[model samples]
Target: MKCITRSLSCLILATVASVAVACSGADGADGAMGLPGADGEAGVKGDPGAAGENGDKGDPGTAAATEGTLTGTVTDAVLKDPLADVTVTVKDSGGATLGTPVKTGADGKFSVKAPVGTVVLKLTKTYYTDSADIMVGVIAGTTVSIAATMSEAATGAPTVTLAWTGDDFGYGKTATLTATASSPTGSTLTYAWANNTATKIGSVAAGTDPKTATATLPTLADATKLRTEGGVETQYVSAYKLPDRLEVLSIVPDTRGAVSVGVTVTDGRGQKATASASLNAASIQTGLRNVALGQRVYLNSGHDGTNAWTLTTKPAGSTATGRGGICSPPPRGGEYVRGGRESRRDSRGRSSAT
Candidate 1:
């Protein structure tokens, strides 16, 4: 009890002193505040905490990363099966290659940077023609998918055949030509029918467009005819028309030859093919050009001969002398003397005897 009383007395004395100091601060008169003290130094930095566990691997990146993506599958044209190992190359309109060519995987899937504007996609593979040349429009940052196709590579040169409407050909005559362009070896080709002689040989394969062309048959006429036309006064010879010179006005049995037909084909991949054939041309003639029925023994027949190959003499008009185109020239070894008389050529090569 005495000790407790002593502790209480001391606590009481401390409380009394605090109360007296508080009173003095409240009652204090106008005293100027002291200047602010200098700032103390900053505390030292603490050590860093231990690192946290690493995060899970980020989500797998997208299949393609570019301004635009072009993804597609390659397929076989005939088999209709997905094709692998096909190289897909892209080129700009100017023919400039865009980027590294992407190859189709086993799944026939491929992804690449899709070029903008008009662009071409070329697909190529072994033992196959690159028939997957596609033109595409790429939007910025857009993804496009496509299904490309391939054609089996041609094994041999292309085969072609040329046929005509008739067995013969003549000037001023129109004949239909069956210019068959074939791919016996399984090649792609286009048929161009132009200038009458040359035409494309097969249905257009992939990578080519359906081109429109004109098939015009060529007219036949010898340039020599123009020089000789003025001198001829015959009805058939004078009836020829202007520009008619090119027209085969008539089919003379003497004029006969062959017509050549050519054709051009393209593989659509910058490769070209050509073929040619010669057709034995003839005219439709039922009768002979310059022929006549004469007496079996007419030495002096009053007939203007057409041909000068034969000799017709009427005993040289009894004087054994005749002058004409055929007889005037006579024989190379002087005049012919049947009975010690001279024979001359008629207007034609033949000697007409009067």
Candidate 2:
């Protein structure tokens, strides 16, 4: 019995030892857990960059801007200074207004801006006479200056008188009529004279009071006849009468080849007298013939007997001959002798004896 008990105890001890050894082997084989993986390395920060430089400046821009002008002054006749407060206006060639009204300054100066064209500058002042038709030109980008003078206004009635100083009776002769006038206002005078009836000659400006005008008379186209009481056969060559002025004695031609011009002279008191005289034609014809021939000629009984006689050579096959009166024999030429008588008369009826 004692031996069995000892053997049971040894067996239990061996089993215990075996269990302890197995527990020891399991612990050694499995490694301890790595300390929770070291937290991921903190993320590295990005490097700071260098700063950039500024850019360059830009270029300049363009400008904007009108065309041109006309400047001038308005003054009076004396030109002492400019006329102030005068209304100055500019008009185109068609007389259309270009701009607004501009008044003259204290210095009598005014200006206007207009487009390119033909223009007229007009000036007006109170109670003063204005000028007519002052023309100018305005071009692009150009300026023009003009100076104007104004005249004084006129006042009352205009009186006019005319005087004629020329041969009123002659073929192709011109008669001149001059007129003088006196008044406070300006006047325009027109004069007319005729032979048988009234006819208009011409008109002219007599200007501001105390002025003169002139006109040349035209020639008459037809012949006139007259008779005198001295038993003389007189012919009227030409006649002229003033319709507006005065009545004069009748003029006549004398028996001699001369003009008997008559005039009725009135004294300061208005008393009138009749006067007549002979105007010799010899001197006038001699002067006219000398001018025509460019040389001197003989003046006999108021006739240019020297150069008036021209010997014309007849053309071949021509039958020209004297029709009436005395036919002197042809001298040294085969041409026929021709002769005719010429007669002239003044305003009076008279004839030259044959």
User: What CA RMSD would you report for each candidate?
Assistant: 18.1, 22.2
Worst 10 residues of 1 by lDDT: 293-302
| Residue 35, candidate 1: alpha-carbon lDDT | 92
Where is model 1 more than 4 Å wrong at Cα? 1-124, 128-159, 182-188, 194-255, 280-354
Model 1 lDDT tens row, 248-296: 2343332222334455665433234565444333322222232121101
Alpha-carbon lDDT of model 1: 0.49
- Displacement of the residue 228 alpha carbon in candidate 1, Å: 12
Question: What TM-score does candidate 1 reach?
Answer: 0.28
For each candidate, what is the lDDT?
0.49, 0.44
TM-score of each: 0.28, 0.26
Give the alpha carbon lDDT tens digit for every residue of 1-354 in model 2: 999999999999999999887775434566777777667887889898888898898787754224358888887664345778888887878889877979999998988787676778788876467768678877677888888887645432234444555332332233333334443422233332222112222222222332222222222222222334267533233233212111222333331122333333332222233333332221122111212211111112222111123324533544332211111222232433222233434347565422
